[model samples]
Target chain A: MTTLIAPVIPRSRLQRLRWTFADGGVIARGNLIHLVRNPSAILNLLLYPAVMVLLFGYVFGSAMNVAGGGDYREFLMPGMFAQTMTLGVMTTMIIVTNDAARGVTDRFRSMPISRSGVVLGRACADMVNSVLELAVLLGCGLAVGWSWHRGAGNALTALGLLLLLRFALIWVGIYLGLMLTPESASAAWMPLMPLTMLANTFVSPELMPGWMGAISEWNPLSATVAACRELFGNPGWGGDSWAAAHALPLAVAWPVALTLVFLPLSARRYRRLDR
Target chain B: MERMNSLAVVAEGVRKHYGGAPALDGFDLAVPEGTVCGLLGPNGAGKTTAVRVLTTLLRADAGRAVVAGFDVAARPAEVRYRIGLAGQNAAVDEILTGRENLEMWGRLYHLDAATARRRAGELLDRFGLAADAEKRVKHYSGGMRRRLDLAAAFVLAPSVLFLDEPTTGLDPRNRDEVWQAVRELAASGSTVLMTTQYLFEADQLAHQIAVIDAGRVIADGSPDELKSMVGGDQIDLVVRDAAGLAEAARVLAAAAGRDPVADPGARRLTAPVHDRIGALTEVVRELGERGIAVEDVALRRPTLDEVFLSLTGERTARAEEGGHGEEDRAA
Candidate 1:
């Protein structure tokens, strides 16, 4: 007979952190493996933004022009990047809901691992997926004659800001996902389209009516798009509005505020689950 | 001191409620170390709720529970480190392969990479899943998935294990395999606490059984003790001809001093008797004198099923008739 033996608990903070990371990394790998096994979904996500870029660049570009008369494709690329980052809300929501429904979250909750590992692993995997989507969209944009006139450093910063927004929205997806039952998760994606499209993703906010323009300019999506346009040296709508003038700071602030609100909310909801 | 150390799990006056109804109403249990204790109950009896509280998945509104020597409420992390739970739903990932699922659980338990891999392989082989190790769990049969879930729970061989209706949805062959696995686990020194509606399962595996009703332990004893509570041995007889049943019943009543239950279609009569061999002998002689041909007769101890029925039958019948709707509530 094999006797039961107790596991040695980590006593130091550093050791505990290491265990958290080790366990979290394994879970993140599992999420990534799902992405690999289900490539059609990834392909669809990547293709959707590229198709949008082509549709807007060619179909609508002929009649539309920037305030300063620049290439519409270049102007459209930054907005597309921002829109893609925010659209990740749907993917995150669906994945989290699927895990909760499939009993995987319950399995993770029962283990001796760190409680934060489950959400942290999921966030890590979603960020990785975001990066891949960015690469594919960037390539498609280049194929269609969109170029960043700024130097490499600013371009890199633009990409970083885009990913930061994604990181923030990921928490939003997780919170809403955890809050909703699995049956409602599919319906949850319906609101995301209007959320991304009604912003400055396809057209400049200045082109809309006065009230709609003001609201669209203040959108978190708009802030990221406007900031990325400035960083990438792409064409932008000339406006003196407070939001347009402070797009860079608002871009950082929006994501920070969202993280502050949703991260703890999702964590609390997760801990109180099954109550 | 040694005997005190042998107590693996203990709970006192645990209470939990949902929507103003008590799910675990002042429940208490104590299981000694390295032994199997079966919690027997019907639907809505709070067996699953008790498991949830002991496993640290839920907090009791009022009570104290110590599982594997750590207070469940105060030191849930410590208790979690020392116990494994296979819930009513087999909590395995459908997207991952069987081997991957086990390895994933091992990694979550903080095992190193090489050790996790080795343990996953070992568990798959042990659970008869070696051939299907690489197959996705969604592709596996229900029984295979259950075996894998059980294998995941044994990754660390924790001192105390909780199985909530482990074989509820399994076929006879799969149930036998799980029973064998649980027996082997107990023989290998793990203390098991299992909840089962199947009385035979408790009789076959549990060293001690606790019959729970209305969120409380109504009866607690070994299998034989529980059976003895129902009554003495029963004498069953079958006659060759339907017309001979009345004569057999009369002979049984005279010997057993009680009216025997007759099955007219089957031409059989059964009576509860105190003296096992004496009642069999008296009934056989009386039937022979009456010229009634007895096809079969035997004296047998009461089964756990019978004990369960006699204890819970009346209350359940009343509950059904009253239409309380309490049966729909989750445990």
Candidate 2:
């Protein structure tokens, strides 16, 4: 006990940031270690998108034609990227709920470490997983004759936008995970599939009925997909509708809006665990 | 630093409610430094709730508590920095290996990477989990997991430790192992506040026991003092003949200065007696004069189990119906 009584240094802003990252990194490492021990979950996540890409690009690509005279596989890659990133919400939700249910979150809360570290650590780990998922899907896209005709800078920017969308959705996952028990969080998986599929992930909204097209066009997932297509110079309708035309701004805005709503929500839920 | 503070934990009229029902109603306690205070109670007793509040996991709706010399509500981080809590459920991550679990906790406690690793190794060895340190916790048995959890708590050698029902589901052998570990912790001068449902556990480990029920401490004292509260030693006598039972009862009651409990089937009578030897001799003399044949007579002090039953029974009978039904089984 006496050995533990070291002087408490007054932390500067930079020091605090360093401490936060250090603590958050440790927690993130724990999350990553879980993934290593259970490689099946990561393999499933990686396999899900690859299979989706191959199935839609080869099986469905031959039949459907883009509004522009370009390959449908090229047109579908960006949408798959956006869809994979958004579906990360389910992965984050399940992991967070499991941690909370298993008392790991309580153990973290009881420690003297920063409260934000727990959430930030999960966010960081999920982002890393999202990056891996993107790489696997991109590899699958390349294997099926999909290429970004745009410059390297534009392609990288498109990847950046895809990851940004993932970053935003991770907050939503954290918020939902903390709000619901693990059993209820699994229920989120059902709604998420329809939510992503109803967007421009698998097919263009222009091909759908008028009313359904309008709804899909406004779907946040659609905005990121459209934005990625424009950056990658891939074939997309780029619908004349105002929402579709300004896809870049909406792609950024939707994630910002989601983070604004869910970050505080997740933080509040984490703090409320003490009560 | 005020290193010589006598009391490690102090609570004043702490109150907490879940929805409309009060979990802790005006609970008060004080535990001196370097001592093990066993909070003895039954299921649904506020033992877990009290430990949670004192450990800074939950806030009391009213009243105040100070643990490890820091106000629990006002300075929870400071309190957390000095204390360890192994909750009702084992809080270790099941996916991580036993060593990984402790090392993660150590890092969270702000120890450097090397120190954390070294401490994790030391704790695994201390808790006799060194061989299984590399195995994932999911594969660990209940006792092994519990030892790992306890080892995690000891990573910092905290000044104060709170263990809530640490051995609730353990078999006798595992329970004894935990008891040995707790004893070693106390011997090392770490104040321990453990909540337990087993009276014998408290008797074995606690220097002092606080019997709590209905969100309050119904009785608090040394084990012997609490037992004496229920009453002194009792003398039991069995007669040879059923026909002389009434005579034996009257003589025993007169000698003991109280009505003796009679079992007509066994022709036995039991009565509380302050002076064991004197009461025994007087009862034998009286029974002899009354021509009653006695088969067996012995005097024995009551066990802590009897003490706990008597104290909690009296409180539950008069308390409201709702307090005893809610299980505070939160992690």
Candidate 3:
């Protein structure tokens, strides 16, 4: 066999980053194509948003009252968007677990591509699904007369915040996915329900018990939900805590912090899977 | 760029542990360029573990490995460019079509767009997967998927190919297909290191055979070198009746000049023989004379399990060598 060795390996740091994205983009495309072929996986991504919109907006919103007198549906929309973003964890975890279990992760690791690219590819691809899920959730929100009372620019920024939150959770999912088995990862969604609920996605943390409310206010999901509500100009619960007072900054901080912790951990685990 | 080297793969005292006993305890191996080396071992013998280390999927706790002229641990990214691996289980994506799996790997291999597409097409045809190229791997048969797995690793005919138990579960026809494909890869001058349970597969494909037990290479040589060391053909006798097993075992043991390994469940006695025809005739005549009926008899090569028993009990050859060395020193 003629040697395959040569200029393939990246020499410079910038070149390395370029190759990582290029390779990651290839991997991301493959994952997205799988979604197209397997409708069930796509449906799983859609299932959470659809169910949450109905369960919260029509059912629970009918009886609920916002703290400062606004339509409950408007308050519920931002929370639903934030909740859907975090729901990505379940899908990402399951996919990563499957690949890890099936030896797909090992195959990727053995290749000459960038090591972090495999993890990054999965995150990027899941982001595409998140974008689509957000669109559908937005459609449902608009159909139910949940209009954004803010400028279009502010509304788009709110959507960007939700996506940023989703992007960071994607790393968490990748890390956990590498840590768990496929069967257990499938059951992972149950535990995540509490994570989404621990925040202000369903109800204001202000209404919860003392310690629980503090936790909810600090919850990353709560940061995104609170931030989205403010940007969309929906009903904000307006708590006195630092996390409550600065939702936008906390939303950015929480996801960025989680990404910082989990991205390297995921890469390390993938490099030596059995260990 | 440096040209190809003579030894394509080399591992020195590579060790790994998963908590309890280390899987690979000071394992070592060396495969010259462009030769097929078969690694044979029983279950949990660290065959797969060793493959993982050399393939750059796992880093050893100690020691070092060089594959395709780069240290596996220190420069795994560089080493990765020159090797292909088909793990124990088929590692291809099940949801993607067979063609997609290869094309995706091709892209990861740093092939340009047009080249990746063409390479996928060529591999699919070569591996007998062209007809089912469009089908998702989940729908492909075990054999087809395995061929595709081989095809995936063979892209660019990687300088050193590592296949861990490539034919563990396959019918004869499928096994033949894989063997032929491996032969083609070797002919193209690719260094292939394959771990297998079947002695027959090793005989047919491997230029050098390495029998590993408990994570170390206990024996390494050409097929003939191994054959002569492990010894002549084995005479296997299946007694007609379970009651006559003792008598048949006694006969074969006497003829072969060693105790035959008797299987009560199968009513069989297997013993290694120096002279194949003489041992076969003597066992038959003696059994007839003793009125012990014979169900079947055959001359065959040693099974990997039998080889391990003899090799381990050569668990065996090492202690004797140590004794001889001491005696020589004393003299």
Candidate 4:
């Protein structure tokens, strides 16, 4: 034990500290920058959301009556924000799976970096991507007569909530990204898109049938979509006002619970990669 | 020149099994400091498994390994901190540029911005990859990518470097380049443990050599010690007269009291003799006494291939085909 001690602090401790945050930050930033650097990724992140806004606004705007007395675009905006963040989760899975498949993750494993930092960095970057996607999608929403009647403070709170949702979904993506085989993440997890669509992103719970309406009303994503709607001045989507009263707690809880469930599981998958 | 330290790396009874088949079966090694240890084995002989254990990538099922004075299993992080591994594959990201790849690895080792940048530049220059440093690894040719991978392993200045089959797929020139780079790294006081199926690699780069077969070490020594194991020396002679083959064998056998083989088609005579000069003289005298003339006579030491063949009872070339050629059955 005495031999383990160094006259100067062993460099690895300092190195470990550097790797944990500084390196993870660099990797996270690099991954985001790499995404924006590629023209297609830029389009997928920016242009694709813009396209969704245009397509959905024209196609569904007139027929839909949002819970609130406003344009369908306004009701659709918050849900789309949640949807964008949720979609961003898949990128985390695709990128992590791709990295794992290409043996880059193994390279990181052999190095001195903290094991968790690899997935955390990617998750953080995906969160950023989700935020960007939400902002762009909202910008497009505003172009076509979507406006938030909620006060600036509440609007800011809504934006914060959207980002938080993205953050949570990033972990889910990271967890799923770490969990699924690279092949399955692309093939099997493609179904998550339809699953996302099944929720009340575009339709009202009143419009959805009995069982799905109940699912949409209580769905964790619906909770976020509802809270964002209330904050953004969209009409009431159904949630127990009792649950709505605990909105801040629920916002904090969804991410915390998902992270608690997924981060450790992601870490476990990472540890198993060593085997 | 730095004086050699005789305790560079040591492994004691290290064992690793993937599923049911044992990959490393109680393997052991000792590499003197500042010297190169070449690990030679057929595929699945546990060379890579031993490397993975030494580098702390895989835990050993049994036995102890101390690398750079850090216990591999007990103090894996410490072991990882001191050692660098260049796995069988290049392990470079095809998307990143050569310089970025090295920088990323440097960052993984926790080098600060300035240090990582500086080290990446130095490694690019050292590996002669400076020209292609800014190009994505995906664009680089195989040899360039391999050199960059080797450079990544060196950027951290680790005390113990493990190169697992460092030159598995390279042309002769590229292979020489990698070997030169490895030698330079060792010369700079990095203790290198390299595994290679190329017999000449052990003969060229290894200060010490360990021949592993069937997941166990069959031989460990300097190149000369290993060469001496099969037999210290041998004599080959050609007989001018076809009728002299039988007489040659009889005369050599009578003179040396050792079995001599006659290849009548090639008119060649071969035998293993303990004393080269004395045996040659006695054979000459006895063959003359038997009236058989020798066309040519030459003495030579055993090659490493011959040494491997003698120890494992199979040719090194054939062993490599059945051994080490199998895709790692690792989970």
- lDDT for model 4, please: 0.74
The local lDDT score (0 to 100) that residue A268 gets in candidate 3 is: 75
Clash pairs, candidate 1, are none
Stretches off by above 4 angstroms in model 3 are: A1-17, A59-65, A267-275, B1-5, B250-259, B264-266, B274-300, B314-331
lDDT (0 to 1) per candidate? 0.83, 0.82, 0.83, 0.74
lDDT of 2 by residue, B1-331 (tens): 4233699999889999999888899998989999999998777779989988987878889998989888989988888778888888888888999999998888877778898888888888778889999999999887888888888887788889898888978877787788888887898889999998766677788988898887888888887787678787777788999998888888888888999988898787878888778888888888788888878877655444455556655434333322222121111
Docking class of 2: acceptable
Candidate with more favorable, higher TM-score: 3 or 4: 3
Off by over 4 Å in 1: A1-6, A45-47, A50-75, A207-211, A236-239, A273-275, B1-4, B227-309, B312-331
DockQ of 4: 0.21
User: Lowest summed-lDDT stretch of 10 residues in model 3 chain B?
Assistant: B322-331
Model 4's chain B yields a TM-score of 0.75
Worst 10 contiguous positions by lDDT, candidate 2 chain A: A1-10
Residues A1-275 of candidate 4 have per-residue lDDT tens digits of 00111111235776556556766686787687577657787888778878888788778677777664666787787778888777767777788877766556656766666765776677677767776777788788788777788689998888887787777666677677777787888874567776666666788766777787766655567667777877887765554445445655676678678878876777776677546
Ranking, TM-score, top scorer first: 3, 2, 1, 4
Name the top DockQ candidate: 3
Tell the DockQ for candidate 2: 0.39
Higher-DockQ candidate of 2 and 4? 2
- lDDT tens readout by residue for model 3, A1-275: 13343436677999888888988899899988888888887786667667878888888888887766678888888888888888878889988888877677777778877877877788789889889999989988888888788899999998998898888878788888878899999888788888888878877777889999988888888888888899888886758998888988988888889889987887776655746
lDDT by residue (tens digit), candidate 4, B1-331 = 2222457687788777799998988787888888898998766678877887777777788988788887777777766666777888788877678998888877766666777788788888888899989998889877787788888877767778888888887877787788888887887788999998765677789888899886778899988787667665556677888988887887777655677766779898767667767877777777777777778776655444566678978775553242222111111
Would you list the clashing residue pairs of candidate 3? B312-B315, B314-B317
The fnat of each candidate, in order, is: 0.44, 0.54, 0.67, 0.36
